[model samples]
Structure formats: structure tokens, C-alpha cells
Target: MNYLCEMSEDKSANEVRKIIHVDMDAFYASVEQMDNPDLIGKPIAVGGSKLRGVVAAASYEARKFGVKSAMPSSMAARLCPELIFVRPRFDRYQEISHQIRAIFYEYTDLVEPLSLDEAFLDVTTNKKGIQSATLLAKEIRERIYQEVGLRASAGISINKFTAKVASDVNKPNGQLTVIPEEVETFLEKLPIDRFFGIGKVTATKMKELGVRTGKDLKQKSIDFLNQHFGKQGLHFYNIVRGIQYSKVKPNRIRKSFAVEHTYFSEIYSKRKILENLEQIALDLERRMKKKSVSGKCVSIKIKYADFTQQTRAKTVLEYMSTKEEFFPLIELLVEHLEINKPVRLLGISFSKLNTEETELDQDKQLTLQF
Candidate 1:
């Protein structure tokens, strides 16, 4: 079919789509709980307990006491004096993540992973030929529990945003489906804060402007919103009208591979900066190989102590995958830049991607885990 005809067919298909958003319940903390029965039903957090450290994940029990992920551990401690803290086991989590991803692939290839814990799946045309999305969601959740021993919440809707929001409506081992006919009503009653992409600051600003709910937001003129919130204003306008058109990208194609590190203290020594750059190059090399991608363009980003940032780039003669080929260009780029102030951050990225997927054995994939 021609591209335009295909798009017209896609639009019609979308009207009856079966998009499912699946989110693992308290993934990190739940993994910790499942491995240790003694930790079940107890207030536990997975992350460092040091004053400067942040909570990586909080169990449902800890959440009752106002402890949440990314909150300072000290604050979490104050919230629940008897809170038990466990260090994050990222390798274990990643392994479980891959296992869960395997289950997703059994259902549909149109899976877009939002994180290690959540994903969006377009199952309109699924392998199982299941007609009802609600039934498919139930089966998926059941399989996850039986196979992975983890509870997953699911949401089914005609589009991604609605499906994502509905997933949270009934969380921690629950599911909800919003049918095509109810899309407008569902969004209208939803609080502005509950809409994806509208953060605390924006929510507060919206409240002050009488944009308290999707219904309120829908009443505002696009030009007025555009004048106030720039391009995002138009986005808000469209989504409130149930007009989100983003697709589920399964391959998870990456445009660039990069690694960055921020130093607590600024460094003026050229030797220290170069050392950091070299390390970053190695890290980027590992990331690229993991994703099975390389690029012809290379770039380096430098942030000064004053928070000023600059990026320098070069289109190399060939696609480069190893750090050895890119290190010399990185050095040259750093040398060419004006460095009157100490450096606070350094980063390296490779763009203009080569799309060929790298075939790796199971052992190689395991070794490539970050």
C-alpha cells in the first residue's frame, strides 16, 4: 500500500486499537521482597540510606509512611523510623527486566519500553488473535505472575496516553480499560496533575490559571495556551481533545550513544580532564556495542563551572565503533575549545547511527549488561 493510504488505514485502525500499558508494581522493592520472604509486608526501601543518597524504590508499606523513590534517604528515615533499607541490585533487576521483556515479545512486537518497570504495547493485531484487549491484559498479567513471580498492573485504551494514565488508576496488581466511546469523558474528569508530562510546577501554574482539570484545559484557546506555554501549550491542547498520535516504536532505535559524568568539584588540570574524557569514551563504546550501533559523527560536550555548556562535533571518515578511533578526535575537539574556566562536566556522544542489529550470544548479552 502507498504511504498515505497506509496512514489512512492506520488512523482507522487506531480508532479500534488495543494499546496496553503494563507497569511492574514497586519493581525494585518488590524484587527485594520476593527474594526475602522476611521482608514481605514490612516497610522497606531499596537504595542507600546515607544522608546524601536517594531512595531508588520504596515498597507499598513504606509509601504509606510518605516515603517515595528519589526522596532523600534521611527524609525517608524520618518518615518511617523503622524503615529497612537495602542496596539496589541493578544486575538482578536488569535480568528480571529482560525476562519480563521476553514475555512481552510473546504477545506483540510493538512494545515500547518506558523504563525497566513499564512499557506500552500495541496489540491491535496480536499473535494470540485475542479480540478483547481486556482479556489479553488479564492473560498477560497472569503470565507475568506465574512466570516471573511479579505483580503487574495493566491499562487498555485506544491510544498510548490514555492507556498509560489508566494503568495507574488501578495499580499494584490491577487493570482498567478505557473504551473508544469513553475517551473524552475519561480525560475530561481527570485532574490536570494526573496528565502525563504535566509536572508539579506546570500543574501549579495551570491551577492558578483555572486549568484544574482536563475539562478546564479543553476550554482554553490554543493561541492563549501557545502564548503562555510555548509549543507545549499546543501539545496540552491536543491531548485534552484526545488527539495524541504517537506510535509504539518497538525496535527502540537510538539516535546517539553517549556517557556523561559531573564532578562534585571543578577540575582545572588538563590531565584530569583528558583522563575523564578517555573513561567516558570507553563507557560510550560499551553502550554502543550493547545496542549494536555505531555512528559516523562524533561530538563532545563540555560544561564549565559557571554552568555554561558547549558542544563540538565532527563527521568522521567512516562509522566508528571503538573508542580507539574516536579518542584522538575527542582530544582535538577539547584542545580546540576555549577553556578559561574549570570544567564541571564532560560528555561524549556518537550520532548518525548505523541501523544493523548486532547479533550476540546469550553469554555476550549477559556480559554486556550495564
Candidate 2:
């Protein structure tokens, strides 16, 4: 009787705020379904209005046929002949994103949005005082579906990295949580490729050094890992230990937001290169609009067919968010670029975001405290 009473008392006294990450699966396609009932049963792909356009999202039905985002629309069609490609409606997407953000704010202002479809919320001392994070994730997912006609995946863990990874374990309305005791063991046996922060380039490098699994990575000395891969090696070390302290940055500053694309065949002509940059500038404009900021610095990235890369940046006289002004910055970037080498990829980024206050530099750089 004494032990039971103590347990009950502790449960009431020990109130810890829980952080939860919620990610919508195929968010754009889901929104399309919500708008059009006929599209619900069909395989949908969002984006691809032009011949040069790419797929921004693919529904689960189309995913079975290997369709994916960032893939060329032509290639996606080749892969899934039945795929229905639609032009992106940014207004609709933004409206839905706002609705989701509003829901998160209703719970806690501790919400840190990673993207339109993904966010982390800290509800440690919330009004609801919910105990189970898993149940909370379920309720949030249900609310999203019922109110917005969308599906979302959720991950609940002690920190952001683990929660983000756990959210992907099950997709398309899935929710998973990392119980405290199981975290370490679960990370140890995980494949290096699946480990957070290990991108394709790093994975290839790790394989060359015989580090295929998380267990394999666990064997390496910090000195050895750092000597080879720089600070990223330190990241590998922490994740293996199942100790990531990275906080959900309340509002990550829009510093140098850009998109790049690699061509199957490199282009040699200057006019063609300028045309491609124009397209990238348009995408940059869209992203800047979404982030709600104008940037004073515009930079361009160029990669050669030989894998050699170069970047040029210029601090403009003033902030600009529209494509009209942003393109001139690209023109300035092209002025300094070398045309001798064929262009494999082209990218554009804008930095020095303008908001009510310029304090974003420090907050945006909030170290992933692992």
C-alpha cells in the first residue's frame, strides 16, 4: 500500500514537458486530395508544370513505382505512367501550413517549425498537462485529418534527432516513440545509412573506410573520425552514444535559402546557363516568400561535371524578395563565373534576412546541443 501510494504521488508531482515532432506525409498531395475529392483515390504527383520542371511531391501510391520529389517530371512519368502530375498551388499549400502552425501554437508557443509539413513542439508545462507523448501525437494527427483531411506522421523522443528519425520508421499516418531505455540499444545496431546526419556523400566515405553500421561507427576513435571528416565526425560520435542535445530552434532564421539541381548532361552555352539560373532564381523567390523575408545577400553555386564546385556571393545595396530583383543578383553572379567548364549544377541562395529585429544571427546559429 505504501509503494502504490508513493508511485501515485510521484506521478502527480513529476511533471516534465514533452517535446513532440509531427511530420505530414506527402503534404502537397494530401492537400490536393482535401481540395479535390476525385483526386483522393488516384495516384497524385504535385509540381511539374513545365518540361524542365521537377516533381516536388509524390503520393504513396506513386511512391510504389519509385517516383520521388526532386526527380525530373519526365523521369517520374517514365517510372509511373499512371502518375498524375499537377502544378504546385503555393497559395493553397501556404494556407494549410498556416492552419497547422495555428494548431501547434494553440498547444504551445514552444513550437519550432522545420518546414511547412514538419514541426517540433515543447509541451512540458502545457495547459493540457498531457502525460503520454504518444497519445498526444495520435490526437494531433487525428485533428489534422479530421480538420484538414490530411495524414501526418509523428515521432516522440527525448530530443529532436531521435524523434525525427523515429517519425520516419512508419510513414503515411504513422507515430512512433523512443522509450528511454531502448534508445541506446536501438541506435547501436542501426545501419549507418539510416543514421541521422549521415548523407549520401558521407555514407560513401564511411563505406570506403569500412564503417557500414552504427556499431562499426561506434568502434572508431574520435580523433580518427575528426581527422578524416572534420566536425561532422563529432556528430557521428554523439548519435552513436544516443545523446543528442540539439534543441528545437524556436524560429530558425532564413539565412541563405536556395535550391540546386544537377543535370544528367552538362550544358556548355552561357545563354542556357543563364536560363537555368533564372529558373533557380524563381524557386528562390518562392522559398523567400514562404519564409517571409527579403535578403540583402545573393550568392550562386556552380558545380562542374568533374565535381569541382565554386561559389560567388555579393552583398546587394538593399533587401529584395521578388524574382525580378533577385535575378539581377544572379546576373552579377554569372559575371564572375567561369564558362570554360560545362555546368553540372546551378544553385542560388539569399542571405541576411530582414525582419523586425536582426537578432536572428545568434538564434539561428543555436548549436545542436548534443
Give the number of the best model, judged by lDDT.
Answer: 1
lDDT of 1 by residue, 1-370 (tens): 2222222323654356779999999999999999999999999988757443467799999999999986767789999998999988878999999999999999899999988999999999999999899999999999999999999999999888899989999988999999888988999999999998899999999999999999999999877887889878777877777676678889766677788776545678767888999998998999888877799889999877555789999997789989888899998888887777878679999888775334235447879895
| TM per prediction | 0.78, 0.77
lDDT of 2 by residue, 170-222 (tens): 88789888877777677777788887678899999998999998888889887
Error of 1 at 224 (Å): 1.7
Worst 10 residues of 1 by lDDT: 1-10
What does candidate 2 score on TM?
0.77
What lDDT score goes with residue 107 in model 2?
A: 70
* Most TM-score-accurate candidate: 1
Structural RMSD, model 2: 7.9
Those runs of model 2 whose alpha carbons end farther than 4 Å from true positions after fitting are 1-17, 49-52, 257-296, 301-311, 316-329, 337-348, 353-357, 360-370
Clashes of each: 0, 4
